[model samples]
Target chain A: MEPNSLVKLNEARRERQAAILLSEIGKGRDRVIREGDTVAGPLGEAVAKAFRSGKSGMFELDGQEFFLNVQVPAPRIVVIGAVHISQALAPMAKIAGYDIEIIDPRTAFATPERFEGVALRADWPEEAMGDGYLDAYSALVAVTHDPKIDDYPLIQALKSNCFYVGALGSRKTHAKRVERLKEAGISDERIARISAPIGLDIGAASPQEIAVAVLADIIQAFRKRELSAAEQAKGAA
Target chain B: MSEQKLTEHLAGNGPAKDELQVAQDWMREGRNLAIATVVETWGSAPRPVGSHLVVDEEGNFEGSVSGGCVEGAVISEAAEVIESGEPRMLEFGVADETAWRVGLSCGGKIRVYVERLG
Candidate 1:
């Protein structure tokens, strides 16, 4: 590659990286870095790999070497209730590299002492979710088991691009909850996105175990969505 | 590129962006430099592929292709690449005796491609 072109390429890459990072979009586009040739392309495979794995790497396509540098936003977990399960879930999620926010109107339960080191919001779900708090990178878990607390957030999650939406309840409870959502004008397709009974059915009997199950389910949903998005981008390319 | 364009690019995020800015700065100051990128890895390599290490003519460097395991060798080779203006592909693995000498105790393999940056 010519010195001038190399400079141009690097500048373009930096611009794209900045845009993705500032937006917390976790997306990047880079071309094959090669010697003597101006080998540039969409870098579809690299983009997809970076998006799915959240790890960047270099790979050869058709014998040409390409470097994929990805910057993924920190994944976030928004728990709708500051209950016992949330107490377990918050710390565990933090250990797994997720920024957690606990929301509950009940100030007693949402105290800083109960949920140390985690962001606590003693406000209604709708109020807490106002602007930049919720996005595609966020996972919403409604563990309050209260329709007033969990339902509104679940509806908001469905309306937005939240990757995962889970609500803690029994099968019977979820059925009734679904009927209530229908009455609230939430479409059946959108309501279906909620993972009712909240977590992976690991037969969890304690708050800690349930938190584990919920975290596992959230990760599963996140990975699956990333894979699908990568596939879609590849198809479009 | 213009100074304004360069500044705009540096305003972006990520470790790679920072590395690129450093490279550009060193180049502007007339210092010869080379970049070594992790092109591939096998088994339990510490750093992911696309990880980078930039080396200047005086052996000053930043970033990592194999964490602390094989960076010493990469930096050494990178300095040579800067002087020679030649590119080379380097590979290190547990099965190789050099791997043990370089502290690749994690029993993984990594391939790094070294090249001069304009």
Candidate 2:
């Protein structure tokens, strides 16, 4: 690995961009490839697969061996509510290797006692999530169910192209939310990406069960996220 | 875990330093450095592929290629690689002749690539 390549790879990781360090087995030459950069032929296919799977391994192409060291930023959750559902979801997200940050302006609900070991922000979402705080690798879950609290981040998540954007609400509430988002000038196509009635349709009743459903839904969305950034829709990974 | 340990974990003080970052910093400081990366692993290898163990000329290391197993040998080899500017591939497993000496206790196999960073 060249010192310059190492610097570039670390820069990409710190910036939360996906990259792979491709090193030839015996030649001892390596280069860094960003998520969208194009490489030709069989090696390109292996590179794309490595980016998608977030796995690093040795690949042998036509007897030439290369090692792909994949660096996919760890996916995290940005929940807009510190309510019961988020309280339930926090630990589960941590266990799944996804760190979570809870942002809610409601102090009583966002109390530290309710969110142990969780990154809690008792500020409005607009203030809490500054520019570039949300990205394609994060799953934005807005469960506040309050228009004032939930609307801004949902719009921002769509604009930021979050991989998964979900909201906790019933069909009736989602209908109203949809109208509000449309009025806010978000495209119908963009508004359509919000996974309202948030979570997998697992017949969840309790807050904990709802958390489980949401985690499952986000996991599926992440693993199946689009490979080409040019083709992904709003809120698609 | 103890209360202090749990609080430390919860408070999210990040680990000391990233292995790659350490390698870069050492390079900038004019220290001789070699990096050992787990290029491939099979069975229950402790660390996954792409994991790095950066070693300085003095055998000082900041990361693990086998979760503390087989690191001594890797660091020793790193000195020679730093001297020659040539890369070497090392294989460790329970089936190897060095099993009792430097093999992975986890009953797994791993191929490590060691090279100097310029």
Candidate 3:
């Protein structure tokens, strides 16, 4: 092979090596949870508990308790609106470890200049939310507050295991939206997943406050599931 | 042991270790290891539940279960448990002065379980 090809090969090898190294560390981290069943009985149980609730579990060894949760990868935050809240929220959500994606049909709002380094999708919600868009590790926040755009994604988001689904609107607005969703055939339970009025009641008045409320609600939803599961397990027992 | 540093590591793209080599090292070591996990927390707990720290026979450690409060105590305890091939439940809280002396600042309490892993 030529020298250039050799250099290229060497670089490729390093890249591949790095990639493998990263994956291996991840595997090592998970091995106690995966192959852990045969080796450690309680580690497997801890992982099972973590998977069920996405929270950590405690294991007792040598008369001492150790706490661990399944290493849950951060959820993907796909915002279907590039409004002011999105501007404020995308950065905060990214800081919170959400893989943030902002979608808007308007070029002015959706441009790289506006979002800079953030994932910007200049497409309709229906289009942007394609390809198994929502997953267990996804939180869909509809700050667009425009029904024409927000409704479709809300419907689509309800069809997945999104951990948090929130939309910015008042109770009256949500009620109207719910009526339309009902007309569109959305069930009461699925519609219930949406955090309408969108946020913890931090007496939020500004766009930033609203974003904080919305993020707070999302975090609460994430943490609440763990509590609910524990309650369920206790009830079962 | 810094909460911010650990979150930064986990929240970023992915892990920074080699898979085959780590797997081979694990395979070579081939003994059950005990993993202590923090499952839940509230109110200024040193570390939230779900914090993790793993230990083997050699006293080598990776990860943290508390901000810095009880890891030393946990590690020493975990090594023996890993060797004995049994599990134990550990709790740390500021319910009393002794508990505070263990350094659970903020009066927070956490429950942890440590079990051996193969």
Candidate 4:
């Protein structure tokens, strides 16, 4: 084991980046492979699969054994509302293994008493997550139902490539929002990724039931997320 | 976020200490340490392959490669690996009854690779 490999891997994880510590069994060789770093051949394919699944395991390449200690940053949720649905979604998302944070500029709604144990921010999404909270591993849901409050984060979530970007609104409301996003230079393909009228097609009537539908939708998006290799490494050329 | 923020246990999930961070901290402190990882497993191994257990010179350890079933032996071996700076592969299973008094209660076999950090 290389002494620096452990430190590097830890650093990558702390920065919310995915990494893999590929260690040769018994041979004492090791290296850290960050997301997007390319390796060639059959071993590369195995590494790619491991990165997608975030599963660490033993691998045999040309009869030589190696252990891939793959690490994918835990996925999370960023909510752009402190509404009734978010109040329910916050706790339920955490229970579902997705850390959640709610950002709402409306002080009256963002009160700690309302959010209880959630990671809440009373500031606007532009203020709370302006430094790039939206990422490929995060699910962004704008449930404020107000364009003034929800539009910025929704646009940012699309540009930042959040795995799940959902907006709360009816078909009529989404049609207007779509025009706005298109005018803002968002490509049609990326705009199509938003799950407006958010949540699964379950007959959820109350805020709590809607939270369940949204949580299930987020899980499905995360589990079935496409492992596109293009986003693995940024600026490594 | 820093490791501290990431590990704040903010969510309701179970605690998962970043064992590699602990290992790095020990290394930075100039403490002789060894890392033991479950490189391979068969049957009902408690911990999955690539699970790590980092041990310091004073016999202190963090993480687990097994369900507290074979850590004592792995840690003792790690102390020697730290001293000799040599990697070793140790196997434990029901079939290796002659080598270990302690075997996986779940009837699994695992191969652990212990190596010095340096």
Candidate 5:
């Protein structure tokens, strides 16, 4: 069958599964598991085991079994500089499902008031971004062009498996910053991943516009879209 | 099981079969019903390709293909499908004037299959 037809068939099959699951409601003798129920203890263990194996299981309830599956999506966003762009980017990123956290040494800049709903860490970048702070899904942005702050975090961010890493600067500033990054031991290949002069070339101007560009770049990175030669060069080195 | 548990299970599982079973049951029970499914999408379509919506004889709808733009037309077509006993593939593109009237942000095109599930 054609791919579209196959998709339709698969969807039909899924619909059938939903219908079966719905029909199973109240048809079994056993009850749905509630929190802290001893009867569900074994079933819960089995569910956990199944989840570890990337699958789920069916539990027998009064001679009938019902399948149970659980999926947990990982979420984390770490902004290296508590700049105005970070201020704008944090909320929008949160809306996109990231658990936002801001790390900067400037206590005045990183505060609860500016990032009301976000987690704040007013520690030096090198000290704040500890082990396990950066993960595979973590999206990090270095907007504070201050080398004292941006360079250290860039190294740490490159070392970690962050899904998106973008830096904000003018082209000349980024070029100089790249030289500094090289001095600090980031290879030409590894440093290529940084989206310096970050964001789509939308001619964005103000801090808000810059934030928009940065977020768009991150979205593009997330989608793994075809990048421009400049973007590819920045991403590869 | 209590009605609460039943409703909870339905909400949690949210499987296509659950919706299909509901739709098929309604269809078998002599109710006119139209089922709309997203078959293809390009660009930044709001919903995924396999999203579904089922409408009853009276034009009541469950589920969504998008925010709203294409749904009105889709629901209308779905109702016709239920009445006519024929399946129709309705394609809406961002560039389509009617598409913007409904609210597609981008020019992503999507194909919706409307069939009388009965």
Candidate 6:
């Protein structure tokens, strides 16, 4: 390939990747990297695989080798409370490669010493989520157990296409919470998006175990979304 | 460079700033380049599936597929790939005695595909 053409391709690929990363839609786009002298392979299959898996790797088609580089935005976990569970969940999410932020209006709970190395926002949920920070690539967990602190953010998260929306409470508390949400004009479908009595039913009793369940549930939700997107892409193809 | 500097470079502010960005920058600067990617792995590979190693015509490389074990060989093959405009699939593992000589003593197998990147 000529140097000029190569440069143009590289520039275009970079631009596309930058745009996707900035958008944080959690959908990965694929770029086909073929042998310099070979014709490109079936792009639809490549794109579908890349988007579905969100993994970059090489594949072969008709004896021609192609590398499908899939670019996905970093996944984010936005915890809506700086409680004990948030302290456990934030670092655990970080370890799982999620960009983490703790949002709570209570200054005492959102202190740096308590949640070290994690981003903390002492603003209300509406203000914090106003700038499109919570998108499809984000997972929001409400662990404050205070309706005043968790309700607005839960509503906001339900409205957005965030991959996961979870809140801590018992079945009775969640039932009451649902009624409150219904009174506040939230649709049943939207209210249903929340994983109330949050986290997997691993018989978790302590804050740490609950955090584990929560992160596992969030991962399950994220993977399910990816699988569905991939299936959709495949069906479209 | 020191280990500290290497760590800092890899940990630069965010997720290892897409290695493709480095390849693109080098390509725009009129440098011939080849990209090596981990396509498949068996057992306990050091890096995950999509790890990259970008090699320039002059043998300099950024990123890694096997940390340091198989990069030297990949870089050497990448120089040939850049010249020939052909791709190559490289395999390394403890299963092969020859691979053991080449330093893939980690008891895992990795398959890397190298292609010239425009």
Q: Give the worst 10-residue stretch by lDDT in candidate 6 chain A.
A: A18-27
Clashes of 5: 10
TM-score of each: 0.66, 0.90, 0.54, 0.83, 0.47, 0.72
Question: Clashes in model 1: which pairs?
Answer: A57-B49
Q: Provide DockQ values for all models, in the order shown.
A: 0.21, 0.72, 0.14, 0.62, 0.03, 0.26
Tens digits of lDDT, candidate 3, A136-200: 56788988778988988888887766678888888899989999989888778778878878888
Worst 10 residues of 2 chain B by lDDT: B1-10
Candidate 4 docking classification: medium
Question: Residue B43 in candidate 6 has what lDDT?
Answer: 91
Clashing pairs in 4: A36-A232, A36-A233
Off by over 4 Å in 5: A1-72, A225-237, B1-118
In TM-score terms, candidate 4 sits at 0.83
Better of 2 and 3 by DockQ: 2
Please give, for residues B31-106, the per-residue lDDT of candidate 4 as tens digits. 9999998888888765788788999999998887775667789999999999998899999873444223333345
Scored by TM against the true chain B, the candidates give: 0.73, 0.77, 0.65, 0.79, 0.70, 0.78
Question: For residues B1-118, what per-residue lDDT tens digits would candidate 6 score against the true structure?
Answer: 2344444543543235456678778876878988777877889776677788989999988887875667788999999989987777788773455445543445798988777864
Pairs in steric clash, model 6: none
Q: Write the per-residue lDDT of candidate 2 for residues B66-109, one digit (tens) a residue.
A: 65557778989999999999999999873444443433345789
The candidate that wins on TM-score is 2
For model 1, the local distance difference test gives 0.70
What ranges in model 4 sit over 4 Å off? A203-205, A231-237, B1-16, B40-49, B93-109
Model 5: share of true interface contacts reproduced: 0.00
lDDT of 2 at A183: 93
Residue-wise lDDT of candidate 1 within A120-212, one digit each (tens)?
Answer: 999998888875455667899999889988888887887776678999999999999999999998888778989988899898999999999
Candidate order by TM-score, decreasing, is 2, 4, 6, 1, 3, 5
